[model samples]
Each structure stands twice: as C-alpha cells, then as structure tokens.
Target chain A: MKSAFRQSMAWLHTWVGLLLSWVLFFIFLTGTVGYFDDELDDWMTPQTPTFSATADDSLPVLEQFLATKGADLKNYSVSFPVDRTQPFLTISYRDADSKRQRIKLNPYTGEELTPRATAGGQTLYRMHYRLRYMPTKIAYYIVGVATMFMFLALITGVVIHKKIFKEFFTFRRGKKPTAWLDGHNLMSVMSLPFHFMITFTGFLLLLYTLMPLIMNAHYGEGKEGRDAFFKEYFSRTNVKASGIHEPSLELKTLLERADAEMAGKPLAWLSVANVGDKNSIFEAGSIHKNLSDSRDKWVFDANNGELIKVQIGHESSKSFYYVLRSLHEGLFASTPLRWLYFLTGLLGTGMIASGMVLWTVKRRTKAIKSGGGSFGYRFTEGLNLACLLGLPAGIAMYLIANRVLPLELSERTLWEVNSLFITFSAFILVAVAKAIAKKADSAWVSLTFLTGFLYVLVPIVNAITTEHNLLLSVLNQNWVFVGVDAVCITVAMACFVLGNYLNKIFNVKVNQQEHSAGPDFKRGHAS
Target chain B: MIILLSMLIMFHALLFLLLAMPKYNKQISVFPKRDKKLESNFRHVGYVLLVICIALLIVDNGVGVGIALVCGLLTFLGSLVSVMFTFNQTNTAASLIWLPKKIFGVISSSSAYFYLVGYGVLVTSFTLFF
Candidate 1:
C-alpha cells in the first residue's frame, strides 16, 4: 500500500511537472527579459532625443495648447521630460465624464503631438506578470495556482532524488535523453537557490491571490474594507475640491522646483491634478526607474502654487515589500544583472526542456519493453514534442513578423500577437505529425535548427532594415542592441550543436533498447 | 527600512543556524504545544535572509550577508544530513549524540509551514502600511 501510494505520487509529480513546465519557462523567460524593459524600450525608440525642459520652452507650448484646449487640459497629467525618447511633456487625467485623456506637448515648444501610445516594452512586461488572456485578477489566480504546484514539484523532486549531491556535479553529455535529463537535474540542482528564490518570490509578489481568503474572512469581501485597508495602509487621503479659478503654472518650472526641493535627485515624473482649477496639485520627484529606493514627489496646493503638503519617498513596511518586489524583478541592477538573469532564465528553460524530454524517453523505454504504447502515452509524447520545440519556433515567427510587417501598418501589435499564436499552433500540429510518424527525435533536431537559423539572422535583418549597421553601431557604442543580437546568434549556434548531440543520443537509445529486448520485443517494435 | 529589514532577516537566519547546530540542535518551543506560526517564522525568515543575501550580491558586494546566508544554508544541510547519519549510526553513543539533531531536523522542516503563515501576515501588514 505504501509502495502504491508512492507510485501514485510519482506519477502525479511527473505529469504535473511536465504539464506546467512550459508555461513556467515562458514566465521565467519573459520576466527576465522584462528586467531590462526600460533599456529595450530605449533601444526600440532610439530616434527620440533627450533634452531638459525650460520655462521658456514650456510656457509657449503650454499656452498654444491651453488657448485651444484649456478645457481638455483640465483633467490631464503633466509629465516632465526625463529621457530623449520622452520628448513630450505629458498630461494624463480623466475629463468631466471620467474619460482618460493623455495630452503630450513639446516641453520645449508645448505643441501637442499625437498621443504616443504603442506599448513599447511595457506591454510585454505587464503581460509576463498578468497573462494576456484574461483580466488581471483571474490571470493572477491561475499564475498563483501554477506557482504553488511548481513549488510542490521542486520539493518532491528534491525528496525523490536521494542522490542530490552525488548528482550535483554529474553531466552525461551526448547521451540523448539521459544527457538531457542529467543537464536538467544539474541545472536545477546547482541553481536550486535561484529556483527556490524565484518561486517563493513569485508567490510573494502575487500574495494578494494566494491569501485572498484571509482578506475575505478578516476584511469584508467587498470594496469598503479593501479601500479602507489601502487608505490606512498607505496613509492616503483624498482632498475635497475647493471651488476657485486660477491659471496653471508651467510644468517644467514646477518640476525644476520639485527637484530643487528634493535636493540632488533628478525629477522622474510630474503629475498635475485639478488642472486649471483652484486646488491643482503638481507632484514631482527623483527618477526611479527601479523600485530600489522609495522616493516620490507629491506636491499639491491651490493653482496659484500655494504649497499644500509635500511627501518625499517614505519607507514603510509597504515600501519594503516594493523593494523586495523590485529585487525579484531585477529592477535595481544595470546591464550585468539583466544578463545574469537572462542566462539563468535560459538555464531554467533548459531545465524544463530536459525534464519534459526525460518523461518521453522514460515512457518510450517502458513501452518498448511492454511491446506497445498506450493511447495516453502516445498523446503525451505528441504534446511534449509540440510544446518543447513549437514554442521557440513560435517566438522566432514573431520576430520574423516584426521585421517583415510594415512599420506603419495598422494593428501591428495585434498582428505580432497573432503571429506568435499562429506559428505556435502550426508547430504544434507539426509535432503531432512527427509524433504520429515516430520521428520525434528528428522533429526536435529540425525545429531546433530552424530556430537557430532564424535567431542568427536577426542581427543581419536589423542591419539591413536600419541605418545603423554593425560597424556604425559599434563605432557609436550602441552595444545594447548589438550585444543582444550577437548573443542570439551565439545561442543559435549552440542550439545547432545541441541538436546534433540529441540526434546521436536518440539513435543510441533506440539501438540500446532493441539490443536489450529479445526477438519477441523486436517483433513488436514499430519502424 | 531595507537595512533594518536586512538585519532582522539575518538575525532570524543566525538563530535558525544556531538551533540547527549538531550539539545545540533541538526543537525550539514557541509554546509547549508545537506552534507552527513560531516554527515557520524561523524557516521562512531563513528563506527571506537567503533572498536578501542574493539581492545584496546583485546590488552590492556585502560579504557579511553572503557569509551569514551561506552559514545558515550549511547549518540546514548539516542538521538534515545528521538525521540520516543518526539512523545509520552503529555506535550507541554516536546515535545518542544525533538524537537531538534528528529532533531538531524535524523541527526545522516543520518550520516551513509557520514561516509561510508569518510571511502572509507580514505581507498583509505591509500592504496595509504602504
């Protein structure tokens, strides 16, 4: 009975681990990429120029928009200039009807340009955390559940191994599935610290979902308790509007004044409330690209610039959570940390890949010894191959779409998203076919090679598409894009090498199984 | 705030490590009857310290935090390994010596449950305060 229960748990552990491993891989990959989301956005929109805004530039631009669209400016947020890509002094506020309006102006000229609204990298970053399919609440719940299971798998895996340290330094190269499995175990075991940290932090980051039952039980299950909780927690209070009229001051000047008040910290952003109203507030503070330190600016008063109250970045228990959250997100570090995260993320993905492959290998050997495979076994094998190879193929397809599609094309973002799903679906279908044909190993190699090919071409494609070729980019020190592209190419080359090893291992495993099997087993073997 | 939090995390880590020592290893009683909340505080606080240690490694080179976290991990491993060694120990004196460590090992592993609970409560407090 004990043995039966152990077997049942083992079965559960394997299936659950396999089923969710791919999603977790995607989560890890995208989350790692998002660590340098700001850098990516900057790289993507390299054309934007960075300049400090002065009152001379700010007032004229403000007046131009104000004369024609003062009412529109009433409920808009004015964001001060930070970087070159951000050429606009922006106001984003809700109008009388509570409709969101974002008005971007030349802080230098104050002329409103078209509202800049194509989520550069921010969309991807958010989507990584809150999956794209559903509302954030629902999606987070799903993620939380998945994360819990992943933690379980990690623990069970450690428990089952029994040879943790013995296998710590183990790496069986060029042995097809065994080699893959060994690689997986080594990566997972060696980076146990990282994996544990990531999983725990992931759960903590989404603490709201995991323990909402506590909130529901203690606080009321409705908005009243929730709002009260937040209000008290953050020491936030909403001020009632005082009915009066006053002209809004230049946002650039307000930002400078706020920065001056903060003493040495650069102004990251400025927001205006009650714009053109008597109780308008201008808030500005130090630029915090990362949530390492909690320093923010909240300046408010009558529109005539009477100081209401100023809140500098204050550290509280909540702020500490943010700092931890930032640490998990790798926001505090510069380029090196992002790369370290990316490499570790790949190791994580590789770990998952190996685990998935190991399941199939183990199943195939059992089936061969048993003289045939079950329907469930066949379906799982097919699904495994589909997911393992197909996802990368799909990502490649997205990159291809990004380049081939017209730059000014309508719904380009939608097209990019669609292309990913479409390519993924297509590869999955191919995997099914390969699995049915009993060509799983060949399919793996072919898909890997294809992915490699596509990856290596990205830099070449970029060079062809943009004015910045490799030489000029090198000379101009545009290493970010260049380095990423170069790394992709190297990764592609490594994948090809891996594919070759997989092919040899697949042959050896099949041959070895046939050798161990008697004539009767050979008779049952499919071509 | 982070500096203080870091200190608190390290303190817990050090306490757990001390508790898991082969000679000193014994189940800590938050109350006479095995309270999970108290137990998990030790384990989860260890986990948090480990995370902060990693974050510190990433942000800056604070060798002290690193050394403390490492020692905490070694202590955990040592206690867990000692439990196995006790069961296999042929000499009665050796087995007797490991009995306390085994009890402590049980105590430490069980600490995970309480730690998670404490973390949840703390997070709730953070969200409220922030």
Candidate 2:
C-alpha cells in the first residue's frame, strides 16, 4: 500500500514538473546565452576596431566634440574603448540650457555615430529578465513563479527517486522511459550545484517580486516608492555644472595615470561625466577578470585629473551589493569557471526540456490506452515538439538574420527578435502537423537534423557574409568567434547522434505492461 | 525582517514534517492501504516548498554566525520532527526507539517558540533602532 502511495506521489511530481518545463527550459536557455551576451555582442558587431589608446589620446577628439556640440553638454558620459572590437570611443551629454537636448560623440574622431536608444541583442537580454509586453514588476513576478516551480521540481525529483545514487552512473540511451528518465536525471543531477545556484539566485535576484507585500505595505502601490528608493540608493548627489570653458584635459593621460596607479589592471570602461566642466569626472573602471576578489572603478576628476574615488573603497551598502551581484553573474570568475557555468546552464536547459518531453512521452501510452487521441494528445504532442526543437531553430535563424539583414536597415533589432519568434512559431506548426501524422519521433529527429545542418553551416554563412575565414579567426586567437563556431559544430554532432537513436526508438512498439516494469532486477545495478 | 522570516520558515518546517511523515511511516507501510491522493499531494507540496526555502536562503545571502545558527537549527528541527513523527507512526516494537520520539517532540516545539520570539525581537530591534 505504501509502495503504491509512493508511486502516486512520484506520478504527481512528474506531471506537475512537466507542466512548467517548457517555460523553465526557455528561461535556462536564454539565461545561458546571456552568460556570453557580451562576447556575442562583440561577435555580432565586429566592425569596431581595436582601441588601445588611453583617455589622454582621445581628449583632443572629445574636446573638439564638446566645442562643436557645446550646447548639449549637460550630464554627458564618455565610454572609452574596452576591447579590440569597439570602434569609436563614445561621449553622451545633454545640453545645460535645455535638458532635452542630447548629444553623443565619438571621442576618436569627434563625430556622432548615433543617438541614444536601447535595441538589438540588448533587447533580448532585457527580455530574458523582464520578459516582453508586460511591465517589469509583472514580468519579474511571472519569472519568479517559474523559478519557484523549477526549485520544486528539483526537490521533488530527488525525493521521488529511490535510486538516485545507484542511477548516478547509469545511462541506457536506447531504452524508452528509462532512457528519458536517465537523460533527465543525469542532466539535472550532474549540474546540481549550478541548478541550485541558478534557481536560488534567480529568485533572490528578484526578491521584490516574490514578497511584493513587503514593498506594497512599506512603500505603497505603483512606481512612486520604487522611484524614491532607487533615487536614495543609487543616485549621485550635489551636481552643479561649471560654466568655465577650458581646453579639455587629456583624457588618455588621465587613463594612463589611473592604470599606473592600479599597477596592472585591465580596463572595463571609461566614463567622462560633465564634459567641458571644471568639475567633470573621468572614471575608468577595470574588468574583474581572472580574480576571485577584484575592484571595479578607479574614478578621477577630469578637470585637474585627481583621483576621486575607487569603487572598492566605498563603504556604502551599494558597493557591498556588487560582490553578490558579481558572484551571481560569474563576472569575477576565471574563464574556465565561466565556461563551466555556461555548460551547466546548457545542462539545466536540457534538464527542463527532457523533463517536459518525458511528461508527454509518459502520457502517450495512457492517452493511447484511454483513446484520448483526438485533440488533447495532438495539442500536447505539438507543444512538446515546438518547445524541444522550435526554440533552437529560432535561435539559429536569429543569428542568420543578423548576418543577412542589411546593417543600415531601420528597426534591425526588432527584426532580430521578431525573426526568433517567427521561426520558432513556424517550426512548432510543422512539428504539430507531423505529430498529427502519428510521426512525433520522426518530426523530432528531422528537426534535430535540420538544426544540426543549420548550425554546421553557421561558420560558412559567416565567412560568406563577413569574408572572415574560420582559419584566420582561429589563428588570430579570436576565441569569441572560434568558440561560437566550435559550439555550433558540437551541437550538430550531438543532434546527429540523438537523431539516429530517436529513429530506432520510435520504430519499436513494445507492450505497455512490459514498458512500465520498474526495473530489471536481474541486471546488476551500481550503488 | 529576520523574525518574520524565521516565523515563516518555522511554519513551513512544521507543515513539511507533518506532510512527509506518512510516506516514510514504517508502521503505516503494513496497513494494507494508503491514501494515494493525500500522500502524493503532500509529497508534491513538500518538495515545492523545500526548494523555495532553499532558494530563499541562497538568495538572502545572510550575514554573520547568528544567521547560520538560526538556519542550521531550523534545518535540524525540520528533519528531526519528520523523523520522529515517522518513527512514532511506525511498527517499531522496541521501547528504546520509541522513547525519544515523545521527549524530542515536546523539547523541539518548546524551543521552536523561543527561537521564533527571539528572532522577532531581533527584527523589531533592528527596525526600530536603526
């Protein structure tokens, strides 16, 4: 009786987990991609040349820009080139006379590249966190629920499995339900730490959402309280622009001096605020790379070029928050750890997808037995295929769109995001159609093969589009490009192997009773 | 904040233990029939809540040794309560094994209230003082 009850609980846990699996999968996939968002952006916009100069070299250009666009100098920021691919150093400022007047200038040539706007890959990054169409608060709430479910799934999964340790080293790939469970278990358990960290951090990161009652009770409803809190916590105080017009101090020399002061630290960004003002500050922040504990900004006054503050030196609660943020983002970790994080994220994605697929797979026999094959099966069948294959197809097509689409095109970023949804939707429809034909496995195999083909062709497409050969990129130690290419090939190989296995599994029609047997007691099980 | 948090944690711990007791109940295993729906629902809810609590702990990223002690005590109480409840409902014939269950339950519950009140005071003090 107790065994039967245990089985029922196991069943409940499985189905509930499956219900939220797709959303969880998307969250994991997008989050994994976001881990390498900076590198991906660098890859996508490869036109920017390497910027090796300090702020001193770019001061003249900035000075020229300030003189030309002096009317729009209120609250401006200058970002110096951080990496090799960044083109022109940038400066953005608003005019003092009219706060509405905004200007952006290239510190290298004192030319304007574009105005202030948020779009492109940046949109995708935001979408992962805030979601689309919903207000940030609502989106965060939705994500919070999903993260909560993910945690639930992980815990219940451990509880329901009696042989977790025994099955740790087990993977019988060709078996039906066993194979699916093994895939789910292996992926989920192997990256257990990563899974726990991601889910926990993902929730804590959005604490305001889960316990909005705290805020609502304390700050009242809507944006007023949030705005007030943010202002108090993050905003700088006592800002008065100097009207004195002096030739812009050498920003490059200031940068050199700051770097020298630090002894040896790679720069992250250089921001010149209040340009052409006596009190203007030129801040150069360092990347916290390859170090367990690292400081960020080394700020300097742009006028006399005196060191104002180091971010690490600040004793504010705001400064303390950065350490936790960095730990969560893996920003302070070494490159190897970053890759580990990325791979673990992928495993997390797979864990979600497999669990979802397993749900539909587990239900298929029951559905067929109950003769519920009319619409419910078809709907579920379609949903499964769409989530499993459609998402990857969409990602591939988005990358393809970035390369093929014209650079000068308006709303290019919108198109990229739209293309992802469109391609994904189309593939889902195709999967649905194929599923109705009672060939769900075949659809999966075919789509997996299709994804593999597209991925393998990615490098070829890049070469055709950018005229940058893989060999050249590899030789140049262009790891970002090369790494992307390698990932594509690896994904393709995995798809090929998975497709072959799925083909055989679908052809076999074992008895339902025979399939559901707990385990083969005769087989030697490892503990 | 800490008091409210600890109270919530205590409440969840009680609920989880009560729910988990039946499945792990050794005595109930031989009872010929089990309530499948109740068992499954209990397991499902318990699993979900445990995960959420763990996540909350991770995200809270609490400070100092005091926080650690509180968390550790909460975990110990939770697991102990569940174990004791399960053992009591078991078919154990040994008096030695059964003796601790009653004693532990009373002691744990009494101490739990103290922890809760202490936590509440800490939170109230912090909020009012600074």
List A-chain TM-scores for all predictions. 0.81, 0.81
| lDDT per residue (tens digit) for residues A1-527 in model 2 | 86886787777677668777777767778778777776677567665433445555667886677577554554556655654324457655555555544343455666655521214355555666787667888888878888888788777777777866433334555577877777777676656655776677677778766776766777676789766655655544335667776544665677667778666766655666666777677777665542233456777777777787765534555454554455456665335445656767777787788887787777787776865366767777778888887888777777777787787778887787788889888888888888776667678888988888877777778888885558888898888788877887888888888788777565554343455543553342632
Off by over 4 Å in 2: A1-9, A50-74, A83-88, A95-120, A163-167, A216-220, A235-238, A242-267, A270-284, A290-310, A313-321, A366-374, A508-527, B1-130
Enumerate clash totals for all models, in the order shown.
14, 11
Best by TM-score: 1
Q: What is the C-alpha lDDT profile of model 1 across A413-457, one tens digit per residue?
A: 778767767877887887777766666678877877877787777
- Can you tell me the CAPRI class of model 2? incorrect
Which ranges of candidate 1 are over 4 A from the true structure?
A: A1-13, A42-72, A80-99, A103-120, A161-168, A175-178, A214-240, A246-253, A289-292, A302-316, A370-372, A507-527, B1-130
DockQ values per model: 0.03, 0.02
> Fraction of reference contacts reproduced per prediction?
0.00, 0.00
If scored against the real structure, what TM-score would every candidate get? 0.69, 0.68
TM-score of chain A of 2: 0.81
